[model samples]
Target: MKASFAKFVILFTVLAVAGFSFYFLSSREEPSSLCPQARTTVSAPEKDARMKNILAPTEENIQAGKALFNSQAQPIPCSICHGFKGDSIGVIFQWIKPYARNFTCFQTMKDISDGQMFWVIRNGSHGTRMQAYKKLEDEQIWQLVLYLRSFSE
Candidate 1:
């Protein structure tokens, strides 16, 4: 009877530890990062409208972008801070900075051009919730840009 009681105690301890672990992980906020133009309206000159090299949001591009969005390169998924659907206000992503843009918002995206989007993804915003993805390959950055652009009306 003593041996059986000890086994039960051990099992209960293990279960308690696991439950606490899950709660802590779920509650913790991800490390902070920011965009360069968080408060500035320093806009770049519009690039050539005839910029023939601009890639469209093709099936391949969107799919690859999705992979990157869902990737675990960092602690939390992009969806956690950017919203599972890549737009705040529409979804949750409560950790996003107050100055951050809502990806799914048409008003937010309508004014942004492809080149502007590409630069932000490549270099990240200075003082906002964005972080530079300089390590990501060029194509991958473009893919993510394309995917984010897809949310525009």
Candidate 2:
């Protein structure tokens, strides 16, 4: 009986450790180190030539941007690919190659300039499924940028 009890305790301890390990590893969010992301978009000079967001990140602008990101934008909403929380884990994220840009990752977002983001939003990226928001005025795009920035903040 003593030997059987010891074996049972050992088995329980191993199982408990394994269970806890799996839970913690799986539940944790992806690290910010998944950054310095590569892009095959406009030329460096062209991206640099683009202007940065002119609109400040005021509550009103951010709210407008949130609207666009959630559902108001044309073609499709940003949340469809970038996730509602900007985590890049949207419903269709699994289907997109290279995955979507994770705005929540400051390590990645910090490297992307506002002008670069503006150019991408206006012209779209070459290799990605991002579409050009020609219908959206420059100010609207800037608003969206403000909202995207809020995720990292």
Candidate 3:
């Protein structure tokens, strides 16, 4: 009878640990995998427009973009909403509706042209929380585009 009681106690303890682990993991906020996102921000002409990034994706340029994205950009940093990994699960992800674009998603990023991204970065998305980064120069915006593209690759 003592052996059976001991076995029961061990089984109960293991089950309780497993249950707590599952609960803790599930409660944490995770990034949503919204691939192939249907973007309707830019008009047909704007979406298809081809604008070349004059600045090459050199290590320096990418680092500059990273800095801007993380904390240097005016108004607010992109990482506040886009997340450090560009996964769209930012610090304020729970409060945002329609979530920020997940740059890590190749299916969605592939459809977005450089020009489209440039336009959005300069002008901001009409319906989204993304604000116009007017302070960023065209070259800086291009650098940002290059850095954003790296998330998918």
Best by TM-score: 3
TM-score of each: 0.60, 0.72, 0.76
Which residue runs does candidate 3 get wrong by more than 4 Å? 1-32
Over 79-133, each residue of candidate 1 has an lDDT whose tens digit, in order, gives: 5556656654323344445545556766557667766766766666777666766
Expressed as tens digits, the lDDT of each residue in 18-136 for candidate 3 is 99888766755545446665566654264345777888899999999999999998989999999999988788776667788899999888888888888889888877898899999
Alpha-carbon local distance difference test for all models: 0.61, 0.82, 0.84
Prediction 2 global C-alpha lDDT = 0.82
TM-score, candidate number 1: 0.60
Clashing pairs in 3: none
On lDDT, the leading prediction is 3
lDDT assessment of candidate 3: 0.84
Candidate 1, pairs of clashing residues: 34-128, 35-125, 35-126, 35-127, 35-128, 36-125, 36-126, 36-127
Backbone clash count, each prediction separately: 8, 0, 0
Give a tens-digit lDDT track for model 2, residues 1-153: 999999999999999999988876665445353455554555435646466789988999999999999999999999999889888877776566667788888877887788888877888877778878889998999999999999989
